[model samples]
Target: MVKPKDPSENPTTTTNNNKMFIGIVWNCVPELKLLLSALLFFCSLITLFQFFPSHLSFSIQDLRQCSPFPPPSSPPPLQIQHPQLQTDNNNNNNIIQQNGVIKRNFNTYGSAAYNFILMSAYRGGLNTFAVIGLSSKPLHVFGKPTYLCEWVPDSTGNGSGSVTVSGTKILPDWGYGRVYTVVVINCTFPSPVGIDGSHGGRLVLHASTSGGGDANFNLTDTIDVLEEKNGLLNSASNELAEFNKPPKYDYLYCGSPLYGNLSPQRVREWIAYHVKMFGERSHFVIYDAGGVHSEVMEVLRPWVERGYVTVQDIREQERFDGYYHNQFLVVNDCLHRYRFMTKWMFFFDVDEFIFVPKKSTIKSVMDSLEEFTQFTIEQRTISNKLCYLDDHPGKIYRKWGIEKLVYRDMMKGIRRDRKYAIQPRNVFATGVHMSENTIGKTTHKTEGKIMYYHYHGTISERREPCRQFVNTTEMKVGGKPYVVDTTMREAAGAVKRFELRMIGSALLKTRQ
Candidate 1:
């Protein structure tokens, strides 16, 4: 470092004394500049290579063994179903094979299981619906298209269209223990939704497709295929399971008066069916319209002669008309006549019926109920809005009258279609509305033990000209004339035509 550079060797200044600023052109400066340029060029190459790695396969030439990238994990399994669906058309009702009728029990599966069910399957092409919860009643349903046709057979055979999916869906109740119910929903495709496939027809549910249209059932939602009706009668069944259930009911009861067009044949069979249930103790109480005619009594004599019922002819003594209070009259008279035996009296129109608990017999159950209940009243309010029927007064059929008169003033409020529905609307009664009235006495019996089946009274005596006893029904609004009479010339003329039907039978019976 101490060695003094020769003036020519050091490229910065020339050694020409006063002329040092004017240096000679030398290879030394050229060589020095060339070295600096070479160093800068190498640095730029390194940076350029780092920035453009894609263009440069840059073998570090130093690092040769780097691991190849790990192979990708296998694709996850496709979620095939919400849960699995197993079906069987053997045993009884066509059963969907069940593995999870209920979700796993909590205490058994853990503890805290609430009452609920899971409706998983909607309308996926092939995926079955899964339900995961407790069912309050035994109504456990899942949406699956059932053939709803002939029974399917097994490899071994010996079965019908019955059997729920095997396995258990744990349904835990708050107080009750866990229960498992297998629902083998029966669905027949090409179902007719509206009546007879007519115009403006809607999605009418078929008995085959909609769980027998049972009653009071919960469905998932629209896009949903599950349909169930609530509170179905232990009605007709083809299966043996329902048939084998112990008979707890004693008998069924019915009371009516015959009218034109409604053949006594149907009534006769209806009574016989009821009597079959109770046998020897069967009773039929009937009162026919003797007003303006005594012919009905003579015609129904065979039914009375059988001693299965007692017949009363109110018209025999007086030229009476079926007044406004005729319906109430029947109840009062019957209750008074059978007051001693009638611990509980159910008062309803001819179209109305009393539905009792399945577990108890009619006589025993009714007797066991507290004796103090004087009267139980059931009522339903109908709406002006029509349901099921699009055309209000069309040819399809009429229930109460020829046409339902909608009062624009009264439409906003609740009104009774008294003649047809005890109520005016579908939503009003909440499905066959009813009341239980114990005439001024402590009803110690179970509160909801009894139910009323109040069908709109448009059949039998009320609709036909031959059965109408009262000719007039009078009503005055604001002291204005508002009287409707069935005895007018038009009505009387119609009655005259229908009476001819009975006259032939009447003459024959009298001669016999």
Candidate 2:
């Protein structure tokens, strides 16, 4: 049988025949031409579909993956909703169509539409400006989002403020599982500024991602606009004021806010240890975050009276939840409190110590940074090196020495130090282990030059069941082998002396 002729065998003939047939069809009746055109369009669509698949299903998994917080155990995950699409005045169509079905525009700005987590707000130096923190990035209509903040004066008869819609700027926060966009809004009022310089009032945030559409999203609760009281608010003013004037103290170590009913003895030890180490070169700002023993207060009073320490009650400050969260607040307050007076400040906890291996003092170690001509060092962090102390329950009064220091048996993982020193007026917000934001400057992470030792098992009363240990790794300070032991011993000595004097005074009072 004769083999069937294949079209692929004659490339030139086949192309000519196909073109002639298409030309005939093009000149044929209009209905046939239309039918041919429709078939071609369908074929083209199939080819396109092979290359690009349509994304119809919506899932918040994309946003959740970028969240800084871990996935919650209980509450169900954010349900995927088909977002409404609407066209705006701007030539760009904002319609989000899925599978040939067009849904109505869904405005996220509606108070009931989307969840808004207002973290914090700080009014700018100027009467017209304010910076606010949003829990997550606002959903906008293809263009840059605009934020409008409405300031309503306190019932104390402070007048209302006007809202001039200004452009919005977003800062992605991957650390908190939410994008905390810092929005700057311009607010004006006919009368004098109603927001108190000390006591701030509430404001509503009107956020819109659409092009001049109705701003339906509003964050109402806890929309506090903190007054710009710190001189650091204006960077230029800070630079000018601090240039010639000498600071009163070289550095200030603001101790951690005490809470959770920590052992008074341990607290006393922590305070005294910092005092003995950094007191000469640095002033201390210590705060009682409530639940402090009277005995501990008595031990700290002498230092306070001498002006070496500034004692503050946590109750004096605004209230907040979470242990470390409140601690950050106290640190921020201390930064503002001593911004201009001191050249530098270290936000430190009692359990952690910045161990200067070669230098005697933290200030001296900081001074060494001048040698690094590459960058102007504004802040420095001693790498967190966990050094667990062997449980010595019997030797409560006995001194902490090299033998008691278990350098070999240390925590296995790397502990990044949260404690840091900064030029007081330069940093904006500080976190537990580091500053969230600072002026345009560099940080000197002294991983090798300095060591940060965190003594976790200090309180003899509290014990961990599975205390892991690493090999003996000695951390020497000032060329001394027993540096931690000596410093801890001094802390113990301070506690012991205070206890003895308290007893003696009681006896003397009874005799009298």
Candidate 3:
């Protein structure tokens, strides 16, 4: 440290210091001092590079790898063309994607409400349409929206001239909420319209919802491939033909299936009581709507085997109109089923038993009416003078007289205000309670001796139509306590006898 710099070896440092001192002396002169300072700064920079060349020199690859930002890129191409599709002619229904759209193939599918779709299938002939409702937003928002359709089997099949697509906009039916904007797509399948198995294929539907989006909606779930109504009805007609074959009976009681909390005990009692009371003159046609127990069916097996009762399985066909209206359809179907077979058809529920005082049996009442002048019989349709035979206001068996547990505690029954028996062929259509139109113009109120002994107290516990009736019905004489109609002596007697048979060892053994 003491031997610092040798005067002889450090001559350069001394020279540089002398030069800076000379420049400072000249700084009194403005331009000359500025120029000398610039020269000195440039020399300093050169000296720095000479000492640290490693820090300054770098390659392009090294700079790129060390950089924090990403490299630039170009956008992907637009996808307009659909992919290859695979079709099957034998398959009932198949789903696939083709030409950037989803394709569906089906043999049979019918009109059904879509849970997510507001529009009705709106199918006619070979063409299927989406009847848009209130909730559908504008298709234009997704670019140029169009419903593209094509024929089945042939992958390249375009729509035939008969099959055309329309962008027609219309309002939906009422009850679908207020209309804002709606559009319908006329989705047309291949040729051979109105035939179920003609094409055995379905029209593929694909629609663009956005400017650059793929076909977003597949309408196969919404569209219904329609077939000839008669073709659809053929099997049912055949079944009806067998069911309605003319029987040697004067009266027939028709009703929908026995469902709900109706136990075997009650069903047995009802059937036995009717069979005993009506003798061999009456027959029953019970439609099994749903939920009928095997035990109940077993009890009626013997009677059914004897041809005295017929149980048509209503579940065999699809119920399109829901419970009540389907019930109406079934009841109407019954009228047509036995139109020519039974002279007097009685439409009543199983809980109801028609009571006749003077004429004990239905056959007696019908026979008595034969010579009467109220209605005259004619070929095809009946003479237009007479109407249906109405019962006098009837009483409901409000409570069980014996206090038996079999007669469950209910509000009891009430008077059946209005219900009547009609000639099936004479009536054009039948509803839940009354006929829509009869061959005759006037409906004459018959003598009041006949009454309906309704044991409908336990109706609240039953399923569907029975419960629906009680729930919706505004009773005329409600809030009254249970009152047994003492005049129903025959029904009272039948109850006891049936209870004995039900609890007795004999019927129980037969059940086993």
Instruction: Please tell me which predicted candidate would have the highest TM-score against the true structure.
Output: 2
Q: lDDT of all the models against the reference?
A: 0.31, 0.48, 0.46
Tens-digit lDDT track of model 2 for 277-347: 56555688877766444655665666676577777776532232223434544565565556667876776
Residues 1-512, model 1: lDDT tens digits: 69877777665554454354335435368877998897666555544444344534444221222312232345755674544434343322222345534433212133221123222211101112222212323233332212222212232322232222222222222122223221212222232221111111111111122231233332322222232222121223322232245322222122333333342322332333333324454455665543213443444454456555576654331222222313223332333233333223233344333434456555654565434433233333211222223243353233222122111121224433321111110100001112222123433234355533322433343232122221224433344332332111122233333434323333232210
Flag the better candidate by lDDT, 2 or 3: 2
Residue 468 displacement in candidate 2 (angstroms): 13
The C-alpha stretches of model 2 lying farther than 4 A from their native spots are: 1-174, 177-215, 219-244, 291-293, 315-323, 370-418, 440-448, 457-512
TM, every model: 0.27, 0.48, 0.43
> Stretches of candidate 1 above 4 Å error?
1-266, 273-279, 291-303, 316-322, 325-331, 340-346, 375-448, 461-512
Native-vs-model 3 lDDT? 0.46
Runs off by more than 4 Å, candidate 3: 1-247, 318-321, 358-417, 441-447, 457-482, 494-512
The all-Cα superposition gives candidate 1 an RMSD in Å to the true structure of: 26.2
Over 1-512, each residue of candidate 3 has an lDDT whose tens digit, in order, gives 48677876788988988999998877768886787787666555544443344556454335435544433443655666544545555554444454444665534455222222332333323333333322223233333544444323322223233233433432221222221222334454443332332223344344433332235433422333222233321232323232355656667777755555455544655676677666666788988766355766776777787778888776643323234424544565566556667767776666655656643655666565653322221111111111111222132222231122111112434333455567665654455556645665434344554555555533323322111112111222234322223344436566557546544433443221
Total residue pair clashes for candidate 1: 54
